[model samples]
Target: MIRFENVGVRYADTAAPALAGIELTVPEGELCLLAGPSGVGKSTLLNAVSGLVPHFTGGRLTGRVTVAGRDTRTHRPRELADVVGTVGQDPAAHFVTDVVEDELAYGMESLGIAPDVMRRRVEETLDLLGLAELRERPIATLSGGQRQRVAIGSVLTAHPRVLVLDEPTSALDPGAAEEVLAVLQRLVHDLGTTVLLAEHRLERVVQYADLVVLLPAPGAAAVVGGPAEVMAVSPVRPPVVDLARLAGWSPPPLSVRDARRRAGPLRERLAGCSPAPPRQVADAEPVAVVRRLAVRRGRVEALRGVDLTVRPGEAIALMGRNGAGKSTLLGCLTGLHAPTGGSVQVGGAVPHRTAPRELVRRVGLVPQEPRDLLYADTVAGECAAADTDAGAAPGSCRALVGELLSGVPDATHPRDLSEGQRLTLALAVVLTARPPLLLLDEPTRGLDYAAKARLTAHLRSLADAGHAIVLATHDVELAAELADRVVILADGEVVADGPTAEVVVSSPAFAPQVAKVLQPQEWLTVGQVAAALDGGR
Candidate 1:
């Protein structure tokens, strides 16, 4: 349904083209996945299919791109709205109306569909995406995952033949992500709708794809084939694929159940071996302390009597389902929102009562929306400003950004950059402060496995240097890699807190793929298995 012929995109004033020599076709009624590292033009390619690359983005498109028999070069996004629906990385930017119901119907209204038809489709989409309860809620009041579902519903309600989505499930929890993926599967199988998805979180979506198109390197042509074939050679892969490679299994499995079927011998080999325990922090003064904290936003009691303590040289993962008060607790630490009751302290000072400049030095926050930490028109400008604000050396933030995601130019605007690239930039900006306490919200939302590895190693080094790390994330693999402790929250309360392996392996909803595949064993990651095989453990 979508065809790219000799397609190459080059943004002005860049060292190399964002995409090069891309030639591929996405057949009708199939789910095609775009897999690649950060800053490799996956988002740019998705934009091209929806006629946003050259028409709205001002980039040069060097080939003919067609969707559903119509040339995107000639048919703009508005003209192709009936045939194609596009949802970008950021959901908040996609909404046109304040309320959920209105937003879902806005797309159908734009197409001049009859009011009755629009209402029917909207109601169907709301039910499909489990958004019926949020039908009348304001967009601004919803959680990150909630807004993502609403954004997808708004597109699905239009009943377009083709759906182009970038990171559709990045903000969603495991269950919610499964619901969205199931909806896409139904659309493809039952309705014969074509889906072209670009997602960094492959663990949730890779197994569901009919075909995988892998961009192995930046500016490289894509390799298209069956999901397993592409993943066998793709550097960016999920934990299950990594495990398959470590076990030397042929035709790597894509799902946990498949891997489990093939993991009998490996599990027996590991029967006598035990994974290393989580790091233990020594007795020391706490970096942040929260005692019986409560926060109420409007009519919702976002957080209720939560207690948490972070000491130096420790990494903690705050995990929960959507609207479980994870973000609210993070806000309390950063002083973005004051507690409704109880006491919250960071570096021995009350966070919400502390001064902005002084508080930033003690604690740095990389928010869920990375763009919230960015304002400059260019990457170089943002880096310079970060250096000035943090009193760090010149170009420190740029160096960090380069390490996290390579091939990002200094002149690229944060808005123009890919979601993963923007996130790395925000992380770099916060790292420049070298704060004692570092907080990240969904830090791995858009990061590929390779980029995520680089980030994990960097954060590990910081933790080793006595910096306390607290991450509010849904990426269980990330928590397995970096977090020494896992804290699960439910409805504004701390439900569980303990060592990473103990907390995650006990909960099926939050368990990583490796742990799920190798049950009865406490192995949290493929790296642990690899290390033991290589005699590193």
Candidate 2:
């Protein structure tokens, strides 16, 4: 169990407490979700639970915090490691061992568990998290989602009484996310383990939460209740809840099944109408081309006989399971990886063969690990350097960042920003080049619905202006909102590629919640459905 009594946190430089007068209790075996807008101190609250607030983070902690009756104020993270296991937003930062199997066992080894027990737990965790195939893969070679599973398995292997995760499923595809959440459910029901997580993708996890704690703003009082009660008033909610509100459904539904039950009348009313189609692709020559691309890394064939083409005014989403070659394909386009066979051309020049300066003008990439693209300590410094490197106007990157997420201070450290904010900064850096082709991997991992909407609008404008975009992501809702085409890959090959609606509107694994609720109708987003009814009215 976790308890926070009159708890507040303040850093050295700030006068106001990052968290103000928070009081809450999470019962043993219950899954407690920390919900709030970006930069609203969700991560700060999680750190408090795991004793990272005042201990390692160098922040002032007031009031009492306890986990499993152990006072975190007095206990350092190392002292509480047996009772608490924590996984932060970025998984790669937590790995000490280079190999997946070794990483999973590292936690238990530190805890001094018996070797036999550790081995058994490691195997169980690998199977539980669907990481059996990747057990021997190097942590460096694994995809972002693969690294996430390894991080979680490492934590689960320790068998701590309390589990704390920040955005645990952000990098996982739909199927893998379900597997991890199901494992959590089993832990809570079967073993009475406590789970505390902060996540932005509510649609994936809200239905499973035993309690929801809403921090409305940076210093707002905590609102604690059942999931439904909190979701009704929460500042950020999933598309399903939004649809319920728009249709006057009492006690808003949390899952797609429940919403579908109440959608009969609404569906009938819209039977005669159709949602507006996305922007038409302009008649232009191919901006980039991939022909029979085959990329081999060690023994793994990351891509095999894959083909794709992009044109100006196009937004394409590359989707697949973990290790399914989505990121590998994105790397190919950005010239990060050379193909073993076939050809890739962007702006009529081969990406892997193009000069560095020429590649900057022809193509740009915002990789899955947004931090990889960041080097400067301050936000303003980063923006200024981006402008200089790309020969763009001064303040161009800052203006683009402002459009994405407003109010990021110029002097703030890039490391201090949330995962969502870092991604925004990286995106601004890439867009500064104003290249003919743009590539983004997991573009919306940490962004909330509002920030994602802004991103959608901005990308839509770029597409309209004849810039080509490709997004390799696990966020199905994002694909529904922004992508003109959806290209799915599996086992390093393209499996499904078509218009966004046609590809995802009916698929069980890939469909967004709105589309799932209004199946057979090709409605992909809440905005589109609302606009359709509003137009009819």
Candidate 3:
């Protein structure tokens, strides 16, 4: 469906070409997984294929690019619209309509399809994506997942043979991410549509992909093959893969199911693989408190009568679907959003009532999108400026920044980095503030297992050091591993709140594989699950 022959693209402002002599092809109905560190021209290649590179972006293009036998240089985005459907990481940026059904119809209407055909396509797409219930809902009122689905559905209505998604699930909760992936699978299997998607959260989606494309960071070589081949040889492997390697297994498990199936023999081979005692944090003073909190965002009541408390040395995972009030609750806790009703207290003082400068010392927030925090030219500079006092050693800040960049996979351009890397950088900058309470919104989004594990370990250490953490995430495994408690919100209400095991395992949408495997045990983290499985073995 798509082909790039010696394709080189250079943006006017940049010294080097965004994409350098990229020779690639996408066969009809083939699902291709494009993997690369952020800013290595993954987006550039996609843009070229979709005719947005030279046409809309105004970049110099060299070499031939073809999609469905049509040359990209000659075709504009609108001209190539019927053959390809493109969705980017940020769905909100692409929204052209305010309503769901209208958004779906926008693409078809542009194609000059008959009104009857447009109506049918919109309805079918809504049903296919499980958006029939939300057809009348305002796009702005929808959750991150719902909005992404709408963006995809709007494009899919065009019945394009090829679908190219640039980290489509970056903003979605785990459940919503799964829904989108499931839709992608269905399209490839049932509808025979070609899919080419780029994502950093390889642990979740890699297993489902037929082929994997691993592009080296900035100045490295690109590798492509079946998922297993590429993932094994890649610099960083997922946790299960690492476990497999540690156990001396030939081929690593790609998914949790694969891990469980292969773990039996591996456990037998590695003796003394017993579970460690659960991490214990000593009781500490309360750093933040929220009681009967109600937060209103535009037309949506994001939080309704929610009560929660975070103590120093506690890592709390807030889980919910997109629009489940996770972000809103975080905003309320961080003083970014004032509670419409109820109260929020940081260090026994109301967050809103606290002075901004004083609040900087008590609480730090890393918003869901990392772009909000990045403005400096270099990663080192961004972290340095996050400090409250001028006397802090620049050497210490630079060291911390370097450590954070090294910890994440493919740390290149702060702006061009993947969602996961950006989140890590943002958190690293926030950490420079030395705030007691750290509020992370979807901190695990777009992270590979290794990156996620490293981050989880860091959060665990932070909690051990008496820093309270409130992480709004869709990752149940992360919650299980790092958070002492899990608070679930649905439709602006705190639907579930308890220990990580209890809340995560009980919630159908947010539960990870291990949680389902050990249903009654309520194990939230991979370590806990590994221990349980070790015991059973």
lDDT of 3: 0.75
Tens-place lDDT digits, model 2, residues 132-161: 988888999898998998999999999999
The residue-by-residue lDDT of candidate 3 on 280-329, one tens digit each, is 65666678878888888776677888988788888888877777888888
By TM-score, rank the candidates, best first: 2, 1, 3
C-alpha lDDT (0 to 100) for residue 25 of candidate 1: 91
lDDT of each: 0.92, 0.92, 0.75
Off by over 4 Å in 2: none
Reference-based lDDT, residue 485, model 2: 97
Clashing pairs in 2: none
- Pitting candidate 2 against candidate 3, the one with the higher TM-score is 2
Displacement of the residue 285 alpha carbon in candidate 2, Å: 1.0
The true-versus-predicted C-alpha distance at residue 525 of model 2, in Å, is 0.8
| Stretches > 4 Å off in candidate 1 | none
